[model samples]
Target: MSLNVLITGGAGYVGSHVVKTLEKSGYFTVVYDNLSTGRADWIPDAELVVGDIGDQAALSRVFKRYSFDAVIHLAARVSAPESIKKPLRYYADNLCGSIALLKQSRKHQIPCFIHASSAAVYGNPGVAPVGENAPLLPINPYGASKMMAERAIMDISGSSDMRWTILRYFNVAGADVKTCVGQRPENPVHLIPKACRAAGLGQDISIFGDDYDTIDGSCVRDYIHVKDLAHIHLLALEYLAGKNPSIVLNCGLGRGSSVKEVLNTAQRVSGKNFTVNRKPRRPGDAPVLVADNALLKKTLNWTPRYQNVSEIIETSWICHQRLTGRRSKN
Candidate 1:
């Protein structure tokens, strides 16, 4: 029997990708989202329930309606700068909302829980390729909210039978293979999509702080393709279903790509010229963050397909043109 997986925030960027990936793997998928940032057109065929994760009454109603075997929690306010400006709102939504979801999970007795965590949890690790044991020093409110929710999960799991896996994602990029879905945010901040759009459409791409301590004086990050990251979730679900112990893993390429490198790759992939504007560093921006993916590899025996930054950019540009009708002739 296929497991019925309840994916929160299934209409959003990464969640939507997971939805498509899950369907491809033959899982019975159900989406629960409030449509705050998620689009209605994202989850086309999946059963989508328009509700907030923080609403216990609404959650109970949904839980009563479906017999979910597991859950993939991806719903949260995910903006770092916005979180800094709206700390209380972020806490209420990300932190409090997760607690509410856990209450419902305990009520439903869901066996497995997969959390979509972010690499921002390690605010500023002293070294690159930080391991899972790295200190959780979140400099921004968004990361703090995630760290706090993780603590809550740990405390709750000590008493409950919920087996959970926390995946701390690095910079997620790219789209589905057929371009069925991709990042469709109105205020896009992710580098790959932004740069790809600019490169193909001749728009201005802002380079944040070209004075960072990196190869090109810009910040370095581990860019993981969305499809590869989606497969990691599937692997985590299988691991949990096999009655394995709950684990925390990082989803990344185990390498680094500077901002300039990414922009150059985007240009090279699309064969277009776009203006690059240097801007001041945003608050709480980490100089470098790459994942030590050895544990993920050894634990799940996972192999990433799109590990190259150029491949990520290429796929993203194709999807961007398909979605926006900005096909470039180069």
Candidate 2:
């Protein structure tokens, strides 16, 4: 029998791609999302439970209904800038909701948990290629919330039979290679997609800051393709199945790309030029964050298929055209 998995926030950008990967691997998936950011159309193939992650009563009902072998918790308010303005909201939703989920998982006796974490937990690590053991010094509320949630998982798992894999994602970009699913326009805050949409519409894109201590005086990030990250999730599930010890791993390309580099690539891929504006730095913004993905690669025996920044931007450009009904210039 196929393992039944419960994926919270499985309809959002990363969550939807993870659902597709899991379902394609022959696992039965039930996506539980609040639809605040996730759309119903994203996960058309799997079951969906529309509810807030903070709603323990609702989550418990679903947990009682299904014998889930594992739970992939991806549902969280994910905006770093927004989290700075609303710190309590981030803690309540990301931290408290995770606690609730852990409670329900223990109650239901779920064997495994796959958490979608972020490199933001290592805010401004002052070092490139940050490893899993780096001190979690989150500079923003979003990162702090994720860090606390990971701690909650670790503490709970130490006392229970729950096994987990925490994948601390760097910058996740690109879409499915087949163009089946990608980041939607709803609250487009990421750099690549924002640049693609601006280029498509002939609108100007703004760089948050241009005075960081990076190569281009702009922020640098390790942009991993969403498909590659999705594959890591699959590998994470398999690792848990093989009775590997619960582990934390960094997910990225082990390299860095500047913000201006992303904008340039998006323009080149879309075959359109848009104005670029430099704005003051936003709070909680990191100067540079590159992941030391050696653990993830060695642990899961994984390799990324899309290694080029141009290829990653090209896929996002295609997704932008499809979502906006614009013709691709190339």
Per-candidate TM equals 0.95, 0.96
Per residue, candidate 2 scores C-alpha lDDT tens digits across 98-147 of: 99999999888888999988999998899998999999999999999999
Cα-based lDDT for every prediction:
0.88, 0.90
Output the worst ten-in-a-row residue range by lDDT, candidate 2: 321-330
**Candidate 2 residue spans exceeding 4 A from truth:** 326-330
Error of 2 at 320 (Å): 0.9
What would you estimate as the lDDT of candidate 2? 0.90
Clashing pairs in 2: none
Candidate 2 displacement at residue 240 in angstroms: 0.3
